[model samples]
Target: MISASSQQKKQLQKYTMLEGERKQGQFPLLEMSHLLYGGKDQFDKFLERQNFFDTNPMFKVNHDFYNKSRQDQILLNAERTVEAMKKLSLGDPNYYTPNVLCPQGIFISTVHFAMVIPAFQVLASDDQITKWMTSLKNFSAIGCYAQTELGHGSDVQNLQTVAVFDKQTTEFVIHTPNIEATKFWPGELGLYCEFALVFAQLQVDGKGYGVHPFWIRIRDKETHKPLSGIEIGDIGPKMGYAVKDNGFMSFDHFRAPLDSLLNRYIKVSRDGKVERQGNPKVGYGSMMYMRNILCDQYTKFGGRALTIAVRYSLYRKQFKDDNKQEIRILDYQLQQQKLFPLLAEFYACVFGSIKIKELVNDNFNRISQSNDFSLLGLTHAVLSGAKANYTYFVSNCAEWCRLSCGGHGFAHYSGLPIIFFEMSPNITLEGENTILNLQLARYLLKQLQHIVSKPSAVPEFFKFLSLETVKVDDVTTIDNLIKLLGLNCAILTKYAAQKLMTHSDMKESWDTKSGIALAKAASTFIPYFNMLCFLDTINNKAKETKEILTILARIYGITMLLNNMQGLLLKNQLNSQQIKTLQDTRESLYPIIRTNALCLVEAQGLSDNSLQSLIAPKEGDVYMNMYNFASKENSLNKQQVHNGINYIQKMREVNAKL
Candidate 1:
């Protein structure tokens, strides 16, 4: 190990070097933060929350926490999470921010905040909400959204859990009809929550009413013990989220009050009668909300992952040129190629998430106030595609960031491994990326058909499908690039529609077989939408900000095009010469982006305390931080002689005697 004094000297030198790099940026970093946070006041509020969490002991974790056994990690996380909630008074007005509970990035009680509360807010009747909302908001009763079963994940329609009404008792007897009906993969259900918003098929008078949400208490709130007829326990450790107690649950004729049915959309009467109101699709509102939130989460996750990699790349030096001075990895063309494009992607995700949030909120309000369900289908299609596409991008880019940092990334202290693992589940959860993309394609084909029937009545977003293709003088401009993507989506959607029409007699089987093509058509539209969002963000900016953002936007658009070159060629969206030009243009944008990379990452407004990566301190004192973290906090380094070494020595002695 290097001596402490030597480490300190190296750290100081790197810190000085990083400062010099920061000074070279063309724009003020704070201005970028303002843009990222939506406004200066919002950025200030974020900082206030971040500072509060940083100073609170309940949110702090030892560096060696990562070295603990999974059970120990879960216990620590649970204890700290509950303590933080109690002190912070979660569920109060604006009290729950994503970072406050999980400062180190592992989600604690996320199901309670993201899934359970939203389930109630969207699905529960006003009377039911009034009865239960107080207890929920006070954290007197914790809950999880239990929908996925052992046999069903994305296929919610096929879930086997059953809720049969008992007219005599005025209750619903919820049961796991078979082993496949056991609820699985609920975030807080295992050992934390006392209740769940369980999804099961409702039965009234021996007739099925399809799947619906029911609030069922599974555990004693005071005792934290499983209640009668409820069997619940944690699933084993996963690739990540060691801290989360993701659980499985089985019910044996579990009884819940008749009011337990969240009946804002549909209700069950005491005499076993059913009253259906509003649209059946209103049940999907909670899911759309969560998917929108996931988009925002992806932006933050991608930003932090890139921040760690980019900052470290600037501080870490390798291979010396002929001058005998080692070069920073960020200066290399290959490194720039890997890291800068992701920075652009991070920005795109940030802006795209903002747009999605606005769209979802506006549609939800219109649906609630005016009972206008006309926009629900469009909202679902857009949010589902955005969730899938953004999550996939964040997951892949996080892995790229990890790989770019070399071996240091594999270590827990680097922060990349945790981000990659935590974000990986997003691709599968909310909705599986491929399945969601296919659903988006179905929606698109329907929209295209509508446009064909009524060209002048197309939705604003889909109006491009009705436009005639015009020859472009400059293919590199954002407008032309977006047009090309729109053309590609239209072409792909048309082909998918034709295939569906040809197999109308065997629609189910045809859809199953053509799933891949349908998913690709959906995937093409996401980047197009993302580019539109990015363009909108820059269109209203000041001259300097616009120039920088335009560069980043072009980098994002061109990189996406090059990566999907085969699809573009197959659809004839770009000729060979245009593809070559895109490649060359992408290469030229790298250095311009790299020049502003540090400033862009700094603009994310992530504090060193929240990052908790030894190699990515804002001050750039990585060598010293690594030394202190390993020497002081790593359990393996605390002793001169290891227990394993002694065990091996005893075994060797016994072998000699034998």
Candidate 2:
């Protein structure tokens, strides 16, 4: 009888529960993983790299990473950086980027590989790349991107750091003219980086040539100290990126060699003559390249948080059921209500980002291969909005996922809090989201103006500007929802554009009254694009998994439509009945989706180590691990009674019996 009860207990264990969920999955797991990771080869690489870290004792994480002090974390980060560079097989160009084997969030040298080197690849000449790219990519030298200033974060045109061409010495004198001009907030710049791709105003013969990227050695190789005439140190204490040293710098008229000027677009001669090969506007593109790439990465970043939350929800139980047995929290409709749409939305974001990444790569190729920058404006506009909206979506939902896990999410052991804090910075990074929203609006207005004058010349992407029909009937259909959103975009864009046109000075108009409207307009455009991406992926890529994907798509499409339909409702573009239908359609999906929750989240392919959570072990034994980690590994647990010096003897005297 005891053995039977034991077996029954084993059957009810979360391990068995989660395993059962996995078995109930509608589609094959490997097939889904292959699709999510892009393809078979890519997924294989992910496994290979993931396995390397998984098996390697050196990469094993111990202790609560959250409890680590800044200094300790920084030291550990640096050590890991070196170890990863030594053990990993990287440097295969696009096939094996350096950060591929790295952690999800920012590391000590992330900016070097992700931002600094990529900047040099596009902005640096071929010879410059040949000289420095290998060493940087190989982790021999650390670098950072320095662009934002103390006074100016978004206004690139009005930056105060200047690099004046000194023809006599064949050097550029880089200087910070005022305190406000101090270069600030470059990751890894404080304690680690030896070099920086600094953005400063280019002045040759006392004639300004706009701001440009200059490769400069900021720190000594041997001493690892800031070089002469360079002031560099960490900006102490931030909400996140504790391991990363976001730094500040000021140049005391530091003289850099003539070769420091990244001359891919414009060349500077020894005699101080400037040869401009590309338009001045191309400088803006150089800065935006990293921001554009960041758009696609948020979804992947968000998957880490979702994985932990979803897995934990599956294991966590609450009040007993009618059968006098505890039901898993996931059984509650409220829990499903909170998490199912996010799961669907996560997949939707991934599909959309995949398509956006392709466009970004294509636009980059056009600029490099053919010197064709015709699509530059459109690319900038699309990415500005995407980066802004996608970051917000990921950050917002990540927090939502955290809250859905109830009180356990508050524990750093859950890995939820850290992910939320780290992700919070992305909304303001690259370009501040608010500024980017207006930047996107500015780009759309340009396109809108073109379409207004010449109907035939309206670009297909901007053809949404011509969409006037709004459908309230049959709006529950995915295609109809998409069309209605396009119509909404048209209305918002044209309305904001009209507001700007009322004044001769567009900037003044945008700054005063229409900025909020334009921001709304830009935010509206992103989901429209995402839905488009979703439809494309469904049609072309996901035919085999279409059954599950169809449900997911409808859920995502409906939530997005509902989110944006308030304005439409106020304007009578959408009726209450249609809105209710869309919401009802979304609700109907929760049950089917809750059944497949494990399949959907696991498809993202987040590993246990990558998650780094006590509450979310892949084995589904969450509580035991949480207890062991907190009671055993936590620093306070080193002593039976932490810091109770006077009470130690008294406490021991009282604990006579067990």
Candidate 3:
């Protein structure tokens, strides 16, 4: 372990911690990631591939082929990106973001892997899967998730693009008959993908049957040219994700073989009978699945920022004593206030993400085996809302971390600008947060209606919203605090659910009025969920570990209760004295936690390499090396320059002249 003896050495060690530690299992702060996600085989091979892909061939392929002639580049990059993907062994889940960003065109296709593929797996007929799945996986062809159109994105039922049946050839003729019908915001359609899973109005024998995904090849695989009757190109730049080339496309009369339709859940027979295997919403399963993975994605972004900020804060020095000795920025309470909450948040997010991943996997398994979709459907709404909320919150936190570093934070070298830029698009992608939150509201409303009809069907968690009772445990241990917080989270959801049910017709109006509050209510689950994870870990461990975890539990609950004061007040959940007790407990826990901050961050399992800060050291080096670097760099001399009368008098003279 690096020495923490000198302030200067400690500062220099901060940034170096994230550099290569992810590969070493030294940074993620979690002790049980191996058990939760998989073994070292899962993580190590991924790191190896990340290194390979970040190097020459992939870089050249992305830069020369994808960035140069974006129109033509799109087609080429699609092939190249697929080729790279084919090289992966698929033995492990490879989740590394390349050190360099892929062009938006490519990021779009990559995201499609997360956003759309699961739906195809679940929704496509066996034959349909057999014909395309292998090639799709092997990258013989590239595809896009084309659901959102210029005319209507969130409202799936009202899409303008139509896929009409041509009974004569047993084919589907896809057409964007109007300007609005043109597919918009598809990632690779402008240039890369040869095929797309077009979400079009499935018109069978002149009757519209809402939106359905049809796999249609848009380009010739051999010649790399757009197929007959297809128009696609870039949609131009936006606030972020410039590297991802979001593109627009339209079809004049594109034709596909009859079996091209993804007919897993809902299908049209050769005779034009619309046979339903399941609810159409099941088609949304893949999207919801991506939203779940995005929970981890958000945590990653937040964790990376925290890693940088923590190290940078340690390295950066400000005001000095009369002896002119510089002090680490982290020594200040103001800096602590700005960053420690986020530091705590980083830990919270990792645990929360693991929990969400477990939930996702459980739901996927249950849905895969039993095909009983009630839980899947509920999770779809709830998970998406949770993902949207947590990701947005983390993004904001990361940017604030950047800002807290002042000028150095804006520098790309500090890792904040790219981090900030990279995180912004998460708010709109997969599904816009506003629209997704409404989906949650809708789901909650449905649950409320179910409870009204059959009270026994409601989960115990929703009992608070039942209007009939208020029954929580009389005990108030830390465990109970966690439990009550869980109950509080469920109650908040139920409250919103009941209102949504009571004013079902006013969903849009209520969404407009109470949307932010509803989002807040949805997000309340994160801290509550986080507290449970920590407590669960504690309860499973030795006594001393439990004691340490108890402090975090108190901190987590008290912090949350303070934030949601309105809920506590409106629901009469806690008395005034209890609220004060929570606050007092929180204050008492702060110093106890402060001493353990570095140890806590270490337990998160994030690598020093990924942190990209010099001050936060790895296993080998910490404060001594940083102090040496700082002393040798002569930062104290620079401080003397600032204090020198010559420099000060020059500055004063200039100011007086001005």
Q: Candidate 2's residue-wise lDDT over 370-412, tens digit each? A: 9898777777888888888888877887798889888888877
Q: Which stretches of candidate 2 lie over 4 Å from their true place?
A: 1-12, 89-105, 280-289, 540-544, 644-658
Q: On residues 140-175, what C-alpha lDDT tens digit does candidate 1 reach at each position?
A: 778998999999998998999999999999999999
TM, every model: 0.94, 0.92, 0.78
Whole-model Cα lDDT per candidate? 0.81, 0.78, 0.64
User: 1 or 3: which has the higher TM-score?
Assistant: 1
Query: If candidate 1 were superposed on the true structure by all CA atoms, what would the RMSD be?
Result: 2.7
lDDT of 2: 0.78
Best by TM-score: 1
Off by over 4 Å in 3: 1-87, 90-92, 96-109, 269-271, 279-281, 321-324, 445-455, 460-477, 483-520, 542-545, 575-581, 604-609, 612-658
Worst 10-residue lDDT window for candidate 2 reads: 92-101
Order the candidates by lDDT, highest first: 1, 2, 3
Alpha-carbon deviation at 181 in model 2, angstroms = 1.3
In order of listing, the candidates' clash counts read 0, 0, 52
